[model samples]
Target: MEPRSHKLYHLHGFHSRNLLDTYCSSKAEMPFTYEAFMYPMEKFHNAFSSGDFRGDVLIDFSIGPQIQHLYAAQEHFRDIILLKPTEHCILEVKKWTDSRTGAFDWSHTTTLATELAGKSDQSEEKEIRLRAAIKHVVKFDLNQENLTGSIGLPQADCLVFWNILEAISKDLKEFVRNFRKFSKLLKPGGRIMHYGALNCTFYMVGGEKFHFFKYNESDFRSMLSNEGFVITHLEVSQRKAESDLMDFDSVMFCTAYKE
Candidate 1:
């Protein structure tokens, strides 16, 4: 017999969990606000679940455990990089644990960007732009961590970094640094997609507040070009069935590739 019920449950799980989490955890703190994390978390999960690329290696910076869940459920098991210890948790526990004492290592940003760009296909202008677009985004950054030992995979065909750029507080320099890190994660001819909000605010584990970097279509496209990515698909839509929880017009979805 066809496993009709199994298929149905799998299909409904994303929306059901998203809705339930949102309603149940609205008043909770950073990680506890399940909807805030699950919405984007599921989006990224669904993308991999679609199985279009079935990447040889998937590096998810800052979202290790979420990806681990998806990997466990799916048969397509690629090497995964859960950058830093924070990948295992909803909040940056390392940063919180050493908030007063921890020092930020800014060099990793440039190093990662250079690495991703180096691995990308380098054709003429248009081709290069197209590839980079598939690789990087306006707000998010991808960085390399010392997790290669844990992931135990070779070089990745696709690198997926989740929820890095969305938390940047200040300094355009910091933003640029993150952009570079994201750009370097992709191998040549690999693809990248990022999910970011228009205008949103939330609190973290340490009671620190973070907001999205306000961006429109023009600004977004410009950032892509600056990072040497060609914009393939950019979509903006309002959140359905929900009031303005964060005082924003819409959510931005971007998909691009590295050349």
Candidate 2:
């Protein structure tokens, strides 16, 4: 497998739109990012609102620069730490958090989140909340034994991972090994929100192909169980085939707790 780079993946906000537009191809067909990310977020929102999932620190392990995956849970946590794989990805996120011109617009996603929260599509309020809530954005190396490296981060009450393991791992064993290391970043009984491709081998961004761990729903559940995580919520949505993009049968969204 080739080394994963920003060139092979979508590393900016606007590039993410290509993922939704090109691969999804239709407004009716939910993209993998949307289904896998947004659905779990909606669950987290409701859980937090009802005082079901209370947490002070939330950490995000990202595949790249994208931030939409954290929209639902942003307001619930007192602090948010974004860990990106590369310095380039870190800079990409900073552009938006810093409110620079030409930042990738997340208005659409914020609008959706507002509606989910039983409000009108008030995108500005959502944006303001996200900007204020994101306290730190730092570069992290997932391949390193110390996931956060020299910059120490507290063990989070909740961990969010989206398209991270599947995109970075060369195989299942590597995925599991990295997952174990990542789980250590959370406190005991800390909740996890995981989203990934199901049975997908590869995906494209910027006209380059990148690999994904090929696994099904059963594999995902068994792995979490073996890691001592009790699965509280699991949702798998059937994927629509987009010939030009990566071919996968489903997308998996999971919420689990380390026990």
Candidate 3:
């Protein structure tokens, strides 16, 4: 069956190019230099234009197509679909809340927290607490089950799971098992892009807990190799989190082909 769409989730704030711009703009006090800003943008453009990233139907599954550069490449694809997971997740969460609670009680924060914790233990309680507050006011729930079977991506030529592995659990075995399931979602021979930070904090998605794992290049490469993927490209970038006061000196971005 022909796939209905190509889904690219969390592209708004998480796209590397967007992040680079934020990084540059935040450091505007250092020097008002257009060269510094243009350099990264050019790099991102080149990467996307390259043959490695291919899909006729592109989907932006974030808040929206917040990326300004992608507009320039609209001609390169047949269709571009933009979706907001936040909205859907919120809707699902709300439905769940209403089902559990007879009436909409905006003050019921603990119940959401309990639900998020039960979904994933690695989730940050503080983040969950904060999301619960907003969720109570919003019209939706952000649970994973709500997301299941929702993403309809075209038969992807290549699938990129960039920088997301590090945000999963540290248990390598469990991580590989989970990833294998993700890989199966791809068409045979499709490429898999894997990017990981050496050390990073767990993330909370709309009140859900997602853990982070740290690994060196060798360790991660081996994991991919064992998973039946041929390592194509590996690039390392430095990661610094001022809020968390953590610095992951090296982050690896790997391009692997499913054989």
Best by the TM-score measure: 2
Model 1 Cα lDDT, one tens digit per residue, 33-88:
33333344345445555665466555555321232122221234334444433222
- Report model 3's TM-score to 2 decimal places: 0.50
Task: Please tell me which model should have the higher TM-score, number 1 or number 3.
Answer: 1
- For model 2, name the residue pairs that clash: none
lDDT of 3 by residue, 1-259 (tens): 1111212223212332332333223343423122222322233344555666565544332221122223222324444333233454334334433345432222222233233234334324433333332222221112343323454445545444434444433457755765665565456777654444565444323223334554677777787789788887777655433333223555555667888
Which candidate do you rate higher for TM-score, 2 or 3? 2
Alpha-carbon lDDT, every model: 0.41, 0.72, 0.42
Q: lDDT per residue, candidate 2, 1-259, as tens digits?
A: 4434323232322254455454322244545445534565576566557554558899888666667667667767888999776666677678888999967666666766787778765678788888888999977666567877788989899888877888767677978987888888899889988877688777776676676677888888888999999998788877744555676777777888999
Q: Candidate 2 vs candidate 3: which has greater lDDT?
A: 2
Residue 8 error, candidate 2, Å:
7.6
Q: What residue runs in model 3 are displaced by over 4 Å at the alpha carbon?
A: 1-44, 57-147, 150-152, 201-211, 238-244
lDDT of 1 at 190: 69
Give TM per candidate. 0.51, 0.85, 0.50
- Summed backbone clashes in each candidate are 15, 0, 13
